[model samples]
Target: MPRPEDSVWAVSVAQVASRPGQSKPIDTVFPAPAGIGDSVVGVREGADIRVVGSFDSIVDGLVFTGRFEAPVTAECTRCLKPIDPDWTVPVTAFFPYDSGACRDDRRTGHGKDDVEIVAGEDESEDVYPLSPDGAFADMESLLRDTLVEALPLQPLCREDCLGLCPQCGADLNEDPDHHHDVTDIRFAALEQLKAQLEAEQTGR
Candidate 1:
């Protein structure tokens, strides 16, 4: 069977221009693309990113909101053991297309001399961007960023991970009592002197 993430989900703005206030179902799989790195925000590569949502044409732009889920495979932060877990989260984003007329309509009430400005930071930061020429609204960048952002910074296999032994590099979960004979750095010179004396006495 074809994995859900193997296909790209792109919608042309032209297709939805005629319809307003209508919701279109968006369900597809986002395959791991090349050069996107194996570990996105937190999701591992090759895992399928399932996107299920709808697209609607609002006044100024299009809005996409849906639930996204994927299986995650990564090494445990503490023990370095393989960890496979399911990652799921809800995603909501807006994509603004060439809507200069829409903005003008929204600003109609304001005085002619009054200029409209973006409420805060660059408007693009909050909403995804569609093609300037009103061609297609690409979902690749949004999916990559949303999935990555949903991943935990440090994923653990279990709550109480025993981790690994600092001395012998052994898994503490398996060998909790594993240890090694450690020499104190402060006594290094004395131990070297004692070894030299013992060698001289044996030679004599």
Candidate 2:
């Protein structure tokens, strides 16, 4: 295991392939970097993300299957009220120890540079990378990407949130019955004509 301060989410995988039948159980927590919140709406910077699961040896490399949970803090999309929510994200990733094998395999059509995969690309590029010597696997990048993708485009406090009053910018959830008496612009001519007739009839 890497030091919590230096490589908070990196796990050593040097012995996994040798122990084929064993699966390394993983349970760790790390303070997410402050930059993580810039891409996500509800996530707080420096929040704790708890990862729990295991890495099992496959044929060539290893598979990291885990789940993570973190606190999400953001305003409700409908009412703009501050809210605290929790997100549980499931992660299933494969990191090959020797990416060169894939490059040589005719079926994979991957090149030598395929080992250094980019984020948010096709499934072909989704594989995490192991160190050249296969000593450790860094999970910080993968976890941050997963957490960002897990956020909803518009987070809501509740399914039945009443939202806010458009006219006064008041939270409608607090006063569900509140409303504005706005007349339709199409009826403005009719309303003005009725007012004029009433004024003439009253000799005003």
What's each prediction's TM-score?
0.67, 0.81
Per-residue lDDT of candidate 2, residues 134-169 (tens digit): 778888778777877777788788999999888999
lDDT of 2 at 87: 81
Report the CA-based lDDT of candidate 2 relative to the real structure. Answer: 0.73
Worst 10 residues of 2 by lDDT: 113-122
RMSD of each: 6.2, 4.9
Q: Which candidate is the best by lDDT?
A: 2
lDDT of 1 by residue, 1-204 (tens): 643233365665566743657677877787654333344224655558788888877645667778887776677778888876777789777765545554664457442221222222135454677766555667777777766666676778898998988877898888777888999999999999999999999999
Clashing pairs in model 2, backbone N/Cα/C closer than 3 A? none
Which predicted model would earn the best TM-score? 2
Predicted structure 1: lDDT: 0.66
RMSD of 1: 6.2
